[model samples]
Target: MTHAATANLPFKVHDIRVEGLQRLPVEKVYAALPIQAGDSIDHDQVADAVKRLFATGNFEDVQLGRDGDDLVVIVSERPTIAKIDISGNKSIDEDNLRKGLKQAGLVEGEVYQRSTLQAIAGELQRQYVSQGRYGADIQTKSVALPRNRVELKIEIYEGKAARIRDINIVGNTLFDDDTLLKDFELKPSHFWSFIKGDDKYSREKLSGDLERLRSYYLDRGYINFSIESTQVSVTPDRKNVFITINVAEGEQYTVNDVKLAGDLVVDENQLRPLLVIKKGQVFSQQLVTYTSDLIKRRLGNEGYTFAEVHGVEQDTGSDNNTVDVTFYVDPGNKVYVRRINFTGNAKTDDEVLRRELRQFEQAPANTSLIDLSRQRLQRLGYFSTVDADTPRVPNSDDLVDVDYKVEEQPSGSIGANVGYSDSSGFIFGANVTQNNWRGTGNRVSFALSRSDVRDSYSFSHYNPYYTLDGVSRGFSLFYSKIDFDQTSVASYAADRLGGSVTFGYPISEYSRLSFGATYEKTDITTGDYVAYDIYQFLDEYGDKFNEYKGNISLQTSTLNRGVLPDRGWSSTLGLEVAVPGSDYGFYKLNWSGQKYFPLTRRWTVRTRGEVGYGDGYGQDKSLPFFENYYSGGIGSVRGYESRSLGPRSPGMIYVDNGTVDPSPDPVGGNLLTEASLELIFPTPFAPDSRSVRTFLFADAGNVFQTEFNDAADNVSWNEMRTSVGVGLTWLTAIGPLSFDLAKPLNDQPGDDTEVFQFSLGQVF
Candidate 1:
């Protein structure tokens, strides 16, 4: 039976006496009371106050009653946290588990809630499951302690990591098992017999492995391959598991004919290069998707609103698994941008956003303009996040409005750091910058640092739009003093002051070309330094060993906005040459290439390679000290110290008495050529975050004297040192942080190869 509150009826209220609160202030509870002493109480108000108190999730129960025209309230308060105990966590240390739980708002000596304890248990299970422990279990219990408090005990049963005992694949007749198995990291056995067997496995890894197999076939023209079923069986001992993957491998197909259908504003020939599938080529679904995206981008650049491309695949029924591919173009209703809306900006002005937008109101919404606008916003650094969406207008199919949503973030930051290492020893540095720079397209930065090896001060500014025509210009000035502590063959101390000014022009929607010139005066102090033979020869030609130098470089980059890409490649080429009118004269050329291929949704393979060469001009035969590439450092060779490789020279060898040795010896000169290769592995942890990624990399490279021009001839396999290690990289809130633990695969006698390297920025 339900009773309704009557306004005319009055209920006797008792003196309001609240109980069972420790941390909560008593005054707060009293102030929330709806009934007072010596007055008639309304049942509805009393009930509402009790409901509010219970809804706080702070009390186990609440009771209210009227006593002699006064109100009384009682609450069984939930206990406050006193202590937390964690047990049975061996793989992840107890401290780490506690910290992870604490991040989720579970901490000792704090208020306790049943829901919070349940949440902690769930998070713990997820952490263990992600590490391949599928059979793990966590249970939480609360025990009352003295003084109205409670202690929590988190019990964990982390079973052994699942192991793969056997793996079988069916319907893979086109390729053998050996070729397909190589793509997976989970294997039945490790390469080395003495090492532990490859037994770590999980259902998640099995799914990823199956996806890899499917994508491999799809990328190679088997567009219809699919995994029908995947099954796993566990052994009675609970130590091993067997997996079976049943796949459906359809016929291999090739493109016999290619055609374009639907409305086209541009000629078909203009769009041909963007197609991935051509006549007489293999028919790959990945290629079709990439072709579609490419056409969309091209049309968007041309101011086509709502442009879309669809791939129409037809079976040719030919003997060689051939098919005809037709790309149906739908340059849907060309709509103009009626308005550009900005949101989530409270401090910044509307003009600030408008200045960065490439697509203006009333103009045709094109892909190029939107992309440029996004880049400009990112460069401003005023917003931590920015996104754009085009919501269609109701009852107007041909019209849409663009919305640029931004999450404003602090535009100014300062950082200070201190650390020590064997290579650089003790170091301290600080940087201050204002990314917004008064809402203009400019940035100002100042940095200062002092280390065992170098001291420097720098100031720089960047203008994203330097000219009314949308050119980018930037300038920077810096002064530095570097001291090489003779850990390597060629070492010297130098003081330098330099600055560079650059101007960039957009060659196309995807390309930019820049030309810049730099001037620097390097005062080299060769007190006890032994000059290389090349330096001596240059000295004979009346070239000062220490002097001023300048150089001009032409740089170009073709970048595709690969926010989402099927397959993409980026390449950079630079050319710089210095003549003898300055202190140094050298001709240098550098080339770098990178390719990213999404083998599947869960895995990607990225490869990068670089090569640089220099030739002496006039009296100079090699690069100057500042321009030369120093190997064997954190940024270069990971396992050794900076400038510690190559040939050795001797001059003024200081004995214990600090006197120079009269006899001198010869050493190697700058390396004429160098190359390196890195294989990157993206981790599942923090996958969506782009600023940082974890990878397992193998690096091999060396620097040598010009006389050893042919690496194969003069370099031994032992000299070709290789370092394999794991690294943690952060696309940091400020910039980047990179740390690596590298070990030389082949260590030579008397080589001082350190096992770790730490750097603050990108390697490239």
Candidate 2:
């Protein structure tokens, strides 16, 4: 009945009756009704009640009637969602689809609205389009269940992404089309398009490409260059896209004058060196912006944390295509850090994180110091990510609080493995390591390993902040049973037990000095074919000996990263000497260094050098043969067998048979030298991966006997072996895997050469 016809009718309800209610509770229906039983209701009131019930969205139909002065309410409840299933989804994960459905109010147990299904389909199509899948199709279907519920099945057809067929650039006179197109990430399909995937048409990538195109011209003095228009079209089958970029190549401009204006909190002479822009140079947007950042940072280093720098250009009235540029600097009030807070470090103690901060509370808020603090925390390997923020306190312009947010990562490893390596032969090992043991900023490690040539067990512990002044203290206990007879280089075996107490003091931000005292006892044994030098040493020094050694080392590093450094250098100097009263008195000197220079945005050049010399002193006659150095393997020269690059041992003779058998094992030497140069490259397959490094390297090194044997000559430069190789290292979930293919350039007749070498679970 019409509301107008029922407006004049007034009725007093005796009771309320509900019908056609399937899932909705009767109490909920009563709550929605404006006129209940025992309340005098008019037709206007009944109309309002019906309208309110429909607004709840819980019913598809609501009907109101009166019989014998009793109000009757009938409702057809909306179906509850039973389940949601997604199919044919490839690029987008199923979980993401379910999350989108939930966000769209289509989750299970919620009321099902038919309009929502259509909206979800549209949204799904939009997502596919964003990924260049213009041919994607989505369809949704609902199946009714027994309990007034429905199940939604979303079917998705993710077609192939549209490939870029061609890109046309118009109105380009200053630079060639090839040069301009090189700036764009999107490209026309070429022979390598399938592998690179840059031929795919994506809006996000297109936007970035356009920005690069603008930056390319802007950096070159084309101050007025502008992109007139950009047009993108799709093929009929939706399999290909064509892009067209139109531009205006404006007149090149030159700088007439460069000046500094506004607040000069620092000496102008000091700030002038920071400006990259100069008079008579081409107008460079990049240089201007870089100069601005430099000025801001210079002020920031001086405690002006809120400094603002801007560059303004003024066109000259003369028609010489010249402009005058001015840099405006505003050095706000000097900011002080009132408090330093650590957050999101649930497992780690606050003190552990606080100790890493270079910027302290109640000190000047230095930007570089704060940045260095974050970098130090990240280098600790305890957290996956670290972020720092300095926000001013309310009503205090000069007082700011620094906050450090850290995301804890797994810092402990308990691993056991049975494997084989080219250098180690068959191996089995188990190790437990905790870099942040119990969140106390201490390191503890225990390991036991057995190989065909070596067996060892060791335990070590280190505290980085032993005394809170950045001093490190550690100790190690180790015992090794070495069977050199099973190895390719040695014809002897030894059982050794050793312990060391080590201390490290940080001399500066990038330098450390370390001192270590070690006590070791070695019991030597000769095999059936022992080298003559080994037999002679055993005869002179006996089969067992005790030695006490002390070492002092100094190291400095400015590397940007630990795993894969793009730029920086590190140098180390070490001296090791046996105690005066030891069985043998000797001193060893070593110097090593490595440097990395960034060649481009994605490539680097690295060089490494090492030199070592050792000799007897005081009462000793000769340096111990067991302490000699051998150079080879992946750690040294890649194309060579481990420890096989030294002087040969004199042949051994047996008296039992009137014939002598020669031992072909290598005799390690007291002098060692090595150098390497590498050109590091990026991996194409994993462009965004930081743990994978590929490089091409040339290496030269050798071990030379100085006084081990009378027949062996002194070290010679011509005796240095050389190799060239290409290598790749990948850090997988299990461990780092390294692979190398090398070719020896200058190989001696007795030298052992290997073209291919690989190792697992090892750092190179």
Candidate 3:
């Protein structure tokens, strides 16, 4: 509606009117228009009004006309989407389809645009094509509805993924095609191709395979190896794919000499020892990179936080097939910390974190100390992420600020559960724990539970930094009452009350030594079907007794995380002995260790072991049956029942006509040994979630008695029971929940086995 297209008349409009509007408010059209009834206007204003109306995306066409010096605006409204329907889609879920439609401006109740829908359909088809489904097709149509509304219908037919038929490797002599393809994920068609479908063609998988090919050559001294080309062709039917690769492998090269270049800042003699490769060794790209990293790290340790190192290989003429390697080091200016800052600790006190810092303000910036400080914060079991930054101060080449940012995890957890199980009979419990109370780095916990056969209550408190040197002090009290009238173990009940106090000394950053003293009093009550072993112990040591004990232990850990740690190892060895004048005189030695190895980005391998042996000193060289160790169930062997995998107790029997009566019950032994290996993997479909994990494990363990009447030998590996299972752990807001499904591999005739077990607890 410009002067060239319409009558060139510049005059003031007397009024404004809208035309061809339906199912739309007049105010909307007027709001989009830039031209209004004004004192003066021109053809340029009319053109701007039409452009603004079209820019609203609510109209199919917009035009301006004049009638009696009044402006007349006309528009054709686009059809509004009434509904959406989809069919023949399996690979893509309904939620993703709706999300895609919404992103592409084709959502229901929005104005329909044919071009946008058509373009989205093509983009979706390309996604399938990338997955080797070249025959996939997408069809879209809009059905007319009443009042100018339309229903969008999208149909997707996702064809089968093309299978790999064959693979060819050209220009490779030292390594055969079969040898190179052995490590590839994509393989030729085999007998199980139709069933497994793992041999299906994938562009990403082929790319990885090609990188592996390049690495295979580069690692074996082929310095000039290069891939000429790679071609993947699909059949006309799009049901099969063929791949071919051409490569050039240069002559193998060996290192003749190694030297250092550039400004190392540190002494050359000290940096020379860090070199991993020397003369007469084959050239290796991986070792070269590793050596470069080591050099950079050493430079960082010497106050140069922004050091750089690179390894360059030079040809040693054309005769001997040798290359001289040199590392170029650039140690940037030594920086000093101007200030130290901490953030993201809204709940934790700054003093609690500052005490763990190895780096100080107004000191030379040491990168190693900064990283160590971050690790110290992480190991506190309070924060999920600890990040450190040493950025240069404004316009200062030798000054920087050490800044630490931490995201605190949930240091407090509440757990409560109500359920009924036949074995436990109406089980219910609640637990409250706080590892960092009021941001003082103190721990407090309380627990209470009741069941048909058992009742327990406990309370505890600990201060991790009682003094400035990180010494710890803690104490706990517990009371329990049990009646085992309807359980798998010996039929006996006991009422026990105990309390303990402990002091910890930090031996190093990763280890601690602890000493504790305990006092316990126990009262026993026997049932009609009580085992003879319980009765014998009661008769020898009296029905009730007060015990005094002392324990000393040393523990060490380098775990990367407090909960579900993904790396590092931990170990603890302890000795507990009964004090003089106590009713019991036994001493126990226990040791346990766990190590985690990261296998991949999402997979880890964990190994663990535990062992315990107890025996009395003085005249009484026999261990009390109450101090015995029992294995199996949730925290032990998994498949077997709780405390149900040990020597059987000889029950009291009444002989009739000189025939011995049968009496059998499980009685824990004084010696315990166990070992476990697990493959920790990310939870399926929720791999990005940090609060959940899954693992598969194999466990083997058993309890044995060294000086018991029914003892067969000191120890026997053949008697050990083994189980394999899959488990899942979820850190919910309330607490941590774990579930295990296991199968026993060597269950005996009388062994009790449980296929499933679970525990939900709050760790403090």
Model 3 segments beyond 4 Å from truth? 1-163, 182-208, 335-367, 373-429, 433-441, 449-455, 481-492, 527-530, 597-604, 653-662, 681-693, 708-718, 745-749, 762-764
Off by over 4 Å in 1: 1-333, 342-358, 367-387, 405-429, 432-445, 449-455, 481-491, 526-550, 558-567, 621-627, 650-669, 672-676, 707-718
Clashes by residue pair, model 2: none
Model 1 per-residue lDDT tens digits across residues 1-764: 11223334366554677766767787767666555666665666766777777667667777875444445576777788888888888988988887887887678766688888898888878877666677899989999888889889999999978677778888888888889988886687455522543557755666788878877897788878889998777676656677788888887788899888888877888998888778888877788889988998888777676788999788877677788888899887777787789899876667767876778887877777876787666545566567888887788876778888987655555678899866566889999776567666476888999888678999998786687666888888989876666223233445768887878777764456777777766665443344443234434443233333333334333323222111356666776666456656676677666666666664555565656666567755445434554456565666765555554433344322344444443233345333444444555666665444566666666654453222212434456556777776654555556788887777666455888777653433
- List the candidates' TM-scores in order: 0.55, 0.82, 0.75
Poorest 10 consecutive residues of model 1 by lDDT?
A: 557-566
The lowest-lDDT stretch of 10 consecutive residues in candidate 2 is 1-10
lDDT (C-alpha) at residue 416 in model 1: 87
Mind giving the per-residue lDDT tens digits that candidate 3 earns over 373-422?
98888878788788998888998888999999998777667878789877
lDDT of 2 at 710: 58
Q: Which model, 1 or 2, shows the larger TM-score?
A: 2
C-alpha RMSD of candidate 3: 6.5
- Write down the lDDT of every candidate, Cα atoms only: 0.67, 0.85, 0.85
For candidate 3, give the lDDT.
0.85
